[model samples]
Target: MFDPVSTPDVQALVYASFAQLRHCRYLLLRIQDPAAARRWLRQDAVMGLLKARGQLGRETAQDEALAVAFTHTGLLRLGLQEDADFPFPSAFREGMNQPDRARALADANVETWRWGDLPGEQRQDVHLLLAHFRRTPFDEQGPLSAPALQAGGLELVQSVPTCPAFIERNEDTKESRLFEPFGFRDGLTQPVLHSTAERSRRLQQRREIDREMADDSVVADGEFVLGLPNEYGDLSYAPDDARWPSAGASANAPPHFGSHGSYLVVRHIRQHVDRFEAFDAAHPPPREGAPSLTEQMVGRRKDGAPLVQQPMPPADLDGFRFRVNDAEGFQCPLGSHIRRANPRDTLGSDVRSGVANAKLHRLIRRGRVYAGECQQADHGACGHADGRRGCGKGLFFIALNADLDRQFEFVQQRWIAHPQFADLDNESDPLLGGRGEAAFSVQSPTAGTRTTGLPAFTELVGGGYFFLPGLAALRFLAETEPAPGPPAQ
Candidate 1:
């Protein structure tokens, strides 16, 4: 048990980590009046503590305060945003207006484009729509306070429920498994922040300023909070600067342009564990003492080391000295899910740099393992007789950073989904790769392993991009109602 009184920093970090957990729910509110919405947010029943300023930004401060308050009140944290009033393309709006029978057909097109199947223009439009409503700010320095929630006029229209917390059991029952989407023990290797000492220690492990820069670049504290400067010395922004600028950048630059909140992308991906297990079972490899198909696919032993680098030992425990670069593929295969997700040490010369080019695109991952009996029993067989039908599994993949393209998208498209990774024979991420309907594979020569023809086993059921506005932005959003008509014209 943690005693916050004894260790406030640790307690705060822990609280922050819990807040980081993506289990927080979300809701859509359509307020007939902005004042009423403000009033609704300010209610004591809904309001929590106010976050300090200079945290992220005013917008993010509001978000953080709300999250903290909700968590304290035993209510799931919720992110709220307003709808964009734009002229939806004729074809797009028409699709939204389709009859029930035709809706599915139209939705298929939308989903395809959303998943990046259609042409550039169509995909761009879909991205715009999703991002417009979804993206949030990350002003780290802003206070996480809730003076606004008390002035309510908002009405809840829709909400997504939060996932239940897992209760650990002492028995060796199959129900005790705490695996990730790709089928390996997860939630164990997390960095623990029990106190300020631990956080300071972790910070110490970071690269020096000179080591982190591309060339003679000075690292700043703000860079740590926001992001590293680009070649132009400007703080990196997301989704291409030409595209999503800081709100109102076109008209006027804010006093703190780079100091604005970061961008966060959260995706609810559902993994098909049954299909993955079946694929592994059917495609068993032929080698002595070699990894099982499951181990090979995951690139790690149940203990969390690379299967090739470290032979599974009896005492090998989770969260123990799990180095990313134990060997090319000896301890942890180059393309393991976590390895791909975060190539910590294996970044090579690139690792010398500080957070800037280091791909230190760190975001607190707060997700839950939603495992239960198979919903579609007829579609597949059970992986284990424990009757634990593992499905509906995937990450609440969230990326937070000052810039989107430099941090989040770079990790997703370049590292995780990159087809040509160093010292590995793979075409895309084993767990979350594969274009459209095509299958993907990754081969590790260290273990003489080849995981091939893994079909796409997940889909984006429902997701939206949200902008966590700064406190000022929140006020701006609340104050400025949509204009009535085309101005003076």
Candidate 2:
């Protein structure tokens, strides 16, 4: 029952490409007649157009498809609400204010983080990856077609302003940078796309039969992008008659579905690297033949593998190669920042059960690290360097899913902040866990383990939640706004 090549992994590859191609397009259409706008929503023509365009494969019209669909008003606007506890003392509303200060701040922040501490070889790899994800403007294509407004129909309104930071993280203001909120080198982990081959590979990796469930659950292609069917026998966001008053559904019926759309939560988190480093320096773990501060915090070397579990640290390798892998809290403390965030093998059955509760709740993370200065090769050796000044270091954490409450929030509030994890004294996330009123400490029990105390950090500047609508939704929105014309006569 498993076909490797044309499976979900391939679909994911195609879809990811599609998502990048589509980018963000916002639109503003003005209707000459109010009745026409209502009529447009009632018809199925707009929906049909979206379906047809989505069907086009990547190779054929990737560029054209993107050009035709995205707009300044429809796709580009991310509806973000300000968090109540943002720590910034000054209110800098516009992105362009005090150009020199913003640049200096961003540069200083980047310098302080010691991103340059990474070996030259590692730096090159990171730069290449960052460049690959960058987006370019649509210069090749001409302006898009303006919608015609018939009697009570729609026309183009004012052009929506472009927020360049939406696509790229802020490059100025060091203290308010985005990326690595937790301070680890690679703070975010991304999900692997499930293609048929990918599924087979996963099954083989877990040594599971094709039909039976594997160790790590395998998600079908539709569950993520198109929204798989749920146990309630209702599609997510389905506009059934009973559920939606607009569709004339019964009061008990489920709401109308927007299967193609997904919810995205984008947070602009600022990292207090200076404070974190200072704490590490002040509380130097009684080096009674203990593991170094870096090892104690991450449970691994810079290369990203288990150092405690491996007898011999891999030579010339950034990480260690473990002879054994243990999901239990022994090897890597359960509360270690990375373990708390992912818990891949630790939770086992509990994780599966959680997944079954709401299948559509799954989300994919696509994030980037922005730093103020390129880490110099010698930065990490002594650790006490003048903090860089800039507003361009931190994480641009983005989560995409169909249901916000079930997926993104569940992961953030439950697993990341859950206090009852096995073997850990408290519920502090190793990397980003400074929440409560006071600082807290957790003991990592291993050959060279040391107890470390983490402090509470605050989020100062950030944005809000946004709905990434489908192409059909954009056209519908374009045709609904009231038109500009001679004073009503």
User: Whose lDDT is greatest here?
Assistant: 1
**Total backbone collisions, model 1:** 67
lDDT of each: 0.38, 0.36
Candidate 1 lDDT by residue in tens digits, 212-327: 21121222222222323433355443111121234466443222312233343545567776787787778675676666656754666654554543223323232222232364
Return the TM-score for each candidate structure.
0.55, 0.51
lDDT of 2 at 107: 20
Tens-digit per-residue lDDT, 200-242, candidate 2: 6655654423223342344444344333333333444411111
Count steric clashes of candidate 2. Answer: 66
Residue ranges of candidate 1 with Cα displaced over 4 Å: 1-15, 19-24, 28-35, 49-65, 68-158, 165-183, 187-197, 201-260, 283-291, 303-327, 348-356, 369-393, 423-426, 436-447, 470-489
Q: In every candidate, how many clashes are there?
A: 67, 66
